[model samples]
Target: MLEINGLVKHYGDFTLNCTMKVEPGRITGLVGENGAGKSTTFKAVLGLITYDAGDVTLLGKAPSELTEEEKQKIGVTLAESGFSGYLKVKDVVPVLAALYPAFDREKFLGLCRKFGIPMDKYIREFSTGMKAKLKVLAAVTHRAEFLLMDEPTTGLDVMAREGILDLFREYMEEDENRSILISSHISSDLEGLCDDIYMIHNGEIVFHEETDVLLNEYGLIKADEEQYRNLDKEYILRVRRESFGYSCLTDQKQYYLENYPDVVVEKGSLDEVITMIIGGEKL
Candidate 1:
């Protein structure tokens, strides 16, 4: 449902060059460390910032040139959204609802109630978690088909986070035409929810893979010098040696599992993958 081709955005010292596509009914996670250009890429996609080159198409129309109807079809919850602190929750909800043609007031109010958000309280007085919840509530109540959420679960407790995730799951099931692009530092949040992951580093997309493939096919191998020497170098993506042994990252876990049954093949997490990428360690 979304296509980005050779998207290039340049700042004075950093640049973002990325390419990816999101099909209907899929959740694509964009992950990277702080200042890794994750937010820059998101801004470019939303046309909030101008890019030097490349094209961004959201549901077939360039985001920069999207019509009002097209814009209504997409919902965005950024880290710093344009919500005035002086407005009370009740006032804010209706104000945002009026901007969208398909907004459901009842649904909005219901979500607020379900999340225990006080409708009468000013946004400035709410906790960080409450503000985050309000932003998500505003985004989803409009019934947008595409959601670009940057850390939607930020400041939320475990229960609250899960509830929000469940809401996204339900939204997907309710409409097969919907899609989402979620960027969060919490790898666990993306583990089960994202169909695929796009790992960004130094303003470039370093890795893009299906979530299942990533979890099942990738592994970390820790071995001694003798064991490391016995293994084929071609199979290792990165190797770091210590006083006692070496730690290696590999994509071909099955190969090592079959050949070196004695070698340890522990499953790698999304956090590990991101760490490796950010550290400039091979793949």
Candidate 2:
């Protein structure tokens, strides 16, 4: 449902060049460290910022050419959603509802109740988690087909975060045409939610793969110097040697397991894979 090709953005010292696609009924996770260009990419797609070069299409229309009605079909929740502190939840919800043609007030209120956000109080009186929930409630209440969420769970506690994730899952199940692009530093949030992941480093996409392929195809191996010397170099992506042994990141875990029966081969998580890719090992 969304496509970005040859996206290039430059700001003197920092440069971002990324290309990827997200199809309907899938959640794509945009992961990277601070200043890795995740926000820049999002802004370019939303037409909030102009890129140096590339094409961005959302729902078959270029973002730059989209009308206000077309733009209303997409919802966005940033790390900090700007809500006037003077407005009460009761007043804020309707103001947002008036902007979209398909705003569902009943559904919105239900979500607010489910999330335990106090509708009677002004936004300034709410905690960070409460305000975050309020912002998400506003975004989802309109029933937008596509969502661009930047750290939607940032200020939320464990329970609140889980609730928000469940809401996303429910929303996706409602229609096969709906899609979401979520950007977050919390790797665990995307582990089970995203169908595919794109890891950005140095303002470029270093890796983009199906989540299952990554979990099943790669692993971490720890071995003594002699065992390390015996390993085939082609399978290794990175290696770090300690005084007594080495820790290696490899794509062919099964091959390594079969050949080096004595070495320890442990399955790697998404976080570990990202770390290895961003932080090159010292040999």
**lDDT (Cα atoms) of all candidates against the true structure:** 0.85, 0.86
Structural similarity to truth (TM-score) of each candidate: 0.95, 0.94
lDDT of 2 at 152: 86
Pairs with steric clashes in candidate 2? none
Model 1 bad stretches (over 4 Å): none
Model 2: how far residue 250 lies from native, Å: 2.0
List model 2 lDDT by residue over 37-137, tens digit each. Answer: 88888888888888898889888987889898887888888776558999898997678877887988889888888889888898999999998888787
Off by over 4 Å in 2: 281-283
Could you say which candidate leads in TM-score? Answer: 1
Question: In terms of TM-score, how similar is model 1 to the real structure?
Answer: 0.95
Q: In model 2, what is the error at residue 31, expressed in angstroms?
A: 0.8
Per-residue lDDT, model 1, residue 142, is 85
